[model samples]
Target chain A: MTELRLMWRNTRMVVLCAISAALYAAVLVPFKVVPLIPGVTELRPANAIPIVCSFLFGPAAAWGSAIGNMIGDFFGGVSPGDLFGFFANLFYGFIPYKIWEIISRGEGPVIRSPWIAVKYFAACLAASVLCADFVGWGDNLLALRPFSLLGNVIIFNNMASAMLLSPFILAAVYPRVRRGRMLYEELMPEIKPAPMPRKTLGLALLVAGEVGAWITGNLLSTGYWTPGFLPAWMAAAPYDKSVAMIVSPFMLLAVVGLCLM
Target chain B: MKTTLYIERDSFVHRLHPTAKVFGLFVVFWSIYWVDNPLALMPLALIVLAIALMMGAWENVYRFRWFFILIIVPTMLTWMLFYRVGKPLITLPPFYVSEASLMFGFGRGLKVGALVLASVLFLSGTKVEELAVGLSRLGLPYRLGFTITLAFRLVPLFMESALTVVDAQRLRGYDFDAGGPFERIRRYVPVVVPVFMGALRKANNMAMALEARGFGRTHRPTSFIEYRMHPRDAAAFAFLLALGAVSFWIYYSGLGAIPTG
Candidate 1:
């Protein structure tokens, strides 16, 4: 029993990883509201779960987070990226864990901040973005077809989605997790949190939102929402056509202007 | 004894690379689309089944045998009625089953069923790693290859998570297996929410872990998992080439000779 206690003590880390997988899969798939939620668009934030898991429990836990979500999502009949979706999620899990222990530990306020909570929050958020990119590229390459994972449309949608959703989650969960208050009774005492200027998080959100809006307009207005799914020219169809109509003179002007110039 | 959908064996088909298997499947699918002669397609389908058997995939076939049987019965009846539609040999009040219609339906169904089974044969047997290896070999990048491998690796992990979640629900007095569709759906929320949450957490952790690690550190790293092509691989590749040639020949030889299933 005592042996089990020692084992179970940190095993919750795996459970945390599992929960992370399930949530990402559920929010992105089976339930429609995730997309409806506005900015939490891409499957990349899901990367954060494995990131934290890797930090706390190592590779196995991180992997578990990736795999666990796929299984959960499949049984739920989530959107069909088929095999590509599952693959990106798995390898991406290792990224965050490896980063913290290997490289990022020496960097910035991330390491020096008195409260470990904000540090963890930021770490996970970063992990998710990188993985999301992995999903986009990997999906196109592996599937031999574009638009499997994030593709341009979803990736653009996800960027908007991430800014809106990530911070709230970071704020709500980071303090408890960072302080170690989430551990089972007997793990350890909670760590103190560091003070931050008020509304700093708000400013981050504001900036992210503006950027998201700008990109969405540019990407969507083109009427070609595909990055990999559709060729850039094809994806730029609506924009091209609309812009063509808007600037049809360029065609006639190009011949005369180039000749004149 | 059960000549079910999946044919488990240790023949050349089984020995084929997972990537090759995927390619083969696609070729078969493409062939089906091109061949209008159902009869000719039947033989090809049978050949695929035979190859599957040679590969020692009978166990997998047996698992889905009942499903095929269920499909076959309905299909046979529909074809029989269709083939005899105008000449209805039997008539009942408010329900007249035509022999022509029955024959047509049966034939249509058998063709579809056989194809579905053939697909199942491939899906159940091929390991995801093999697929990744194949795709990578076929020009997918290492990142994509690893992504596919990682995805395949996650399947078992998610399955295990699911079992635990089921057990947890059981402990909480939730009846997951036995219920009406609505009940089944409602029960799923508990299952889904928890599972989705699990995935989300993992994605975050993984991203952080990856960043911490040196993933995407350089353009590309030397591959540790290398697949060298030997003479046997060349021979197999040649055989597929020949198969493609024959398929093209059949297409060009004449559309009329293709038999209808």
Candidate 2:
């Protein structure tokens, strides 16, 4: 609530949000032609923008990422399920800053140590999985494609790009911003802590959810079980197989994310 | 070379109200999904193509023809293979092209084609400012619209500066091309960091400038321009609504379902 108030009341935050979204979109638009799954997925190096900017500008970056992704989708070719993309990207952008605050213990977000790097990477994976799940469910709801396929593809694409690029981006930006005394922490007279407890239950739920996905994926793959509730289109061939293949990595990531938290 | 998605044209499509175009985009996309028959999907592709032809998007289409060959074509082929089920059309020793696969493939393909065509037509014909105006008319707060439009305006500027940053790095003997994937990504650190910092500084300056000019000083702000619905826009909206209704009716009536056998 305070974050929204800060964004709305402060002219600086509003401009920052606009800049973050525009810059994020601008960086991403050129990559529109490179299709990972044609209409379904693309090589989005711009995912790094939210990961980096969230740490730098907080909620402004989060809103910017959501709006920017929607704008980018418009330029790239807006499709039916892109409404999901908008909301999914909102989580993608917002989660990192909050996670960073929890992990950083108010020392601020800089990946100077191995532990910090692990936390940052874990945050990236968690954000990617969450975004992918949201987007995948949206696709299924709209009958755009099978949810599992879209989810796996989105997760792989976003995680790969963010992991590959964010560290370098953060390493580069941190020192310079600090030198200029322009870091988000520096600009604000007081920093509000994120919503409480930060660790126990949320981390536990995330682990349990990912473990469940792993189990479901394995069962579907082995043909030992098939979910009766899913529609024929969604439960059809190759989706179950693909989901099985994809879940292991996410489960591994869940463990890593749990440790980071 | 300056990269731009918008094509310069003065066609009737360009003259249509931006709000109508934005709304019509959703209607058309929704209509696309209700279609499951391959043959029935052709008209959707054709309508968008005809609009593209009128808007002179063919040249841009030709220039980006690789997108169709590389992305769209492969996507169609993949769907055909995966959904193979009906009477065989062609046989390779181990695989058969069947009616169900062909129909399903073409349907998905045409949907993608129509999506791409519509995006090209709309984006080429419309300006970002007009999009913001359309959004505002649709009841988005003027401040939000201004922020979005402002973001759009900044995209080109940021892209240009990012390129400049890349050029500067190249001048510093940075070897971005010779490395393995990870190494190459690491090389981008030099490029992305400076660009991000530059953007941050620019954002700060822009905020100050906007604040000085009375940005966010009021709860409601007046705009110098407004978009009024024209007779043509009304006709366009009616046409879209009618088409969308018919499509939904056809889908519910089972006329557009793909036959498996």
Tens-place lDDT digits, model 2, residues B1-261: 333467777787777898998897778888888897867777777777777787787776676566655545654565654554687887853344787766776677667666666666677777877887877778887677888888877888887877787778779877666655445544556666766777787877887888888987775676676667789888998999998998899799988888888
lDDT of 1 by residue, B164-233 (tens): 7867989988886566433333344444434434544565466457556655565356565565545665
Candidate 2's clash total is 0
Q: Tell me how far the alpha carbon of residue A175 in candidate 1 is from the true structure, in angstroms, after superposition.
A: 14
Worst window of 10 by summed lDDT in candidate 1 chain B: B1-10
> Top model by DockQ, which number?
2
What's the lDDT for candidate 1? 0.44
lDDT of 1 by residue, A1-261 (tens): 121123222334334444444444433333232232122132333323344334444444444555545544333222223344554455345434433433244442123344554554544444444344334333222211222223344444433333333333444444444464442222322222122232234224323432343333334432334445444443431232322232223223322221121
lDDT of each: 0.44, 0.69
Which regions of candidate 1 fall more than 4 Å away from where they truly are?
A: A1-261, B1-11, B14-19, B36-38, B70-104, B141-144, B177-179, B245-261
Poorest lDDT segment (10 consecutive residues) of candidate 2 chain B: B179-188
